[model samples]
Target: MRKIILLLLLSAFISGCSSLSKSQIETVQQFGEVTSNFSAYPSAIMEELAEIRLKRGLYYASTLTDPMRHLDELDSIYSQKKYDYKVSEKIDVTFRVLDKYAQSLVLLSSGDYTANLQNNAAEFGVGMDSLVNLYNVKSNAEKLPAGIGEALGKIVGFSGDRYIKVKQSEKIKEYVTKADTLVLIMTSNLLEYLESSNLEELISYEEKMIRRNYLTYLQLTDTGTFESQREYLDLKSNLDAAKDLKALTIQSTKDLQAAHKELVQVVQKKQKLHSTIKELRVFYQQVAEIRETLNALKKDK
Candidate 1:
């Protein structure tokens, strides 16, 4: 009877151990499934967002050249009026090439290209806002030339005593100063965005292809030169920092909430810098136009 009782006790112990092992295995499998689902979903969403944002940015940059195209059209019109068919044809051909280039940029922007899955999508919207602001500035700058003649006429037509002339001169100065302030504000906003954004590294890799573009506007504006070389260097630094950030981000990935928050901050900074660089381009273009107009007026005199 004692032997039978001991055997029964051992049998029960073995059964309990097997049940515990099975339970543990199920728990681990469930955990893994949860992790896999979380990782895949967020990564896929982020990648799609990044691609869209990059394309949008590139497209906006291409569109920013509409002013230059319009300027070419004006030049062609003037050349035609002067019976300079050769110059007009040349301008038209150049305009066509520019249009094609712009279209290509749009296509490239829209093309299916790979983007870092970890990049933050919300920050991209901020960058887009900066680009929109730049577009508005460019539009305003284009309108300035049309109003300049009228403003100048108003100043010249005002025949008053010396005191009145002095007042008018001050008023004109105020108007010019206000316009300049707006340009400066827009330029500063753009620079701030670039400096804050970490995208400097990405831009640097593409700088070789973009250097000529950088130089063209720099020559036209007095806003200050863009050191393409410096930009490249900064971009390299950012890339190194980004590697460290990526590591931190990856480690924290298991904690989805924390990782998401950290990455968002990193991406926001990068977008800021991207926006700044774009704004700087617009500022340079505007300044160039102003300089050209001044030169033309001097020649006319």
Candidate 2:
């Protein structure tokens, strides 16, 4: 009777220790990979805004009373203390903090954490601390709660030759629960920026300018030259491409936010790992498409 009871207790303990299956860990790794990939997009969008403004300024310079003076003014405005540029810098920092967090997630879930575990954990903790500090300085916001760093430190600080699945689940659940709100804030800020009227207004103004210029040229020339028509077509093509990219970027950002929310649910065991996997794979594919589009645009430039 005593032997049977001891065997039953041992079996229960072993079962409890196997909380996070291999598939679940792999799903987490996928989530981290997609997150790291997605981090560059917001900064790129800001760059696109600056580029468009500069191009628009140059295009309209001929209409100004003193064209040369207008050109100088445009240069100065863009070069010094522009509000949009300042906002862009803050956006960059916000994404950096997010990317760092995603990287820590990858490191924790990866098989490599077993080697030099303490040193690696401490190193990641320091990196997280630095990013959080940068976020505070750049955004002029209160510092993120210290608990996020502390919880993450605990996640990586475990000692053992074998990676413990049960501990991973526990620490990840705690971290995800605490970090979910912060993640939502970062992602929501991005969505708000993207959905704002500033970008749409800029794009609309540029389209009108392009069309007006082309029409004026046609009227003066009584059927424009091949070069003129080609220029108009090229301009239109670029504008169309930019518009398409904007739509994709917005969708991708939403997908990222949704995936992170799903991650929180998965960690809490409120959602099945398989269901999360499907969503993650979809996000991964969408990001890959965005990457390809960005690359094509760069090459065209």
Candidate 3:
């Protein structure tokens, strides 16, 4: 249905228009690509990071010679996800906001000016909807900050192409910049928390390993005193080493988290994102306001 509408609309707008012009193919295509880039919730990322962190601690504990050495060997494993986090953070704000800008033009071009209009539940694309859910916007009454959903809705009602004149006015520039800043801040915070969570979890894993080792030794068979005594000494030594490693990991985690206190506050509270998102939904509200501001600017021009 969307493709049909676009095809019909394209007949009028496809000629003599710059490819990347506001409502042209390039803008829509770019938006589609960017929209597809949305992946992983912040909470999910942190959870996985926590798990991997614990897993590494266990792996390290298994290597009695040097735990950090085993962790160092996991460089390849950790780097892959690290790259993803970096790429996700580098979202094309210029294109994303322009996508929103172009969508507004499409709506305005067709005389569809109702705020937050939607053709169907699926119109906003998975990217925007995931964002909507991530932000915990339960209903339409819960206005999204920064006009994100509304901006998406504005575009959704206009699949048919028209020779829409889209321009980047000053307010639009501010809107784009603000949106990009929010994305950067959001991604950075998530990645930072992931880093910290991984470190913190390692400490936890080490503590558990220490306790489990102690219990296992307690249940050991009553072999000769020599064998039993040596096993007990080795267990105690391993426990001491684990405790030291845990202390170091804890200090490192705390230090890193403290350095990014503001971002931490944005991404989490009590190991979850529900409360953080509720508080941070204000940023979405700010985004929506920018969309309105951009509209007013377009009108003024």
lDDT of 1 by residue, 264-293 (tens): 232223122222233323433433443343
Instruction: Provide the lDDT at 128 for model 2.
Output: 77
lDDT of 3 at 98: 28
- Estimate the TM-score of every prediction: 0.20, 0.75, 0.30
Residue 192, model 3: lDDT of 49
Q: Residue 220 deviation, candidate 2, in Å?
A: 9.8
lDDT of 2 at 20: 56
TM-score for candidate 3, residues paired by index? 0.30
Stretches of candidate 2 off by over 4 Å are 1-15, 59-90, 133-145, 155-160, 163-165, 212-232, 270-276
- lDDT string for model 3 (94-153, tens) is 224324433432332232323343342125433453553444333323333454444333
Give the least accurate 10-residue stretch of model 3, judged by summed lDDT. Answer: 165-174
lDDT of 2 by residue, 89-184 (tens): 666766777887788777667765564664675677677777776777767544575546556676544433333556666666666667776677
Clashing pairs in 1: 190-276, 193-272, 193-273, 194-273, 197-269, 197-270, 197-273, 198-270, 220-288
Q: How good is model 2 by TM-score?
A: 0.75
What clash count does candidate 2 reach? 0
Superior by lDDT: candidate 1 or candidate 3: 3
Which candidate number has the best TM-score?
A: 2
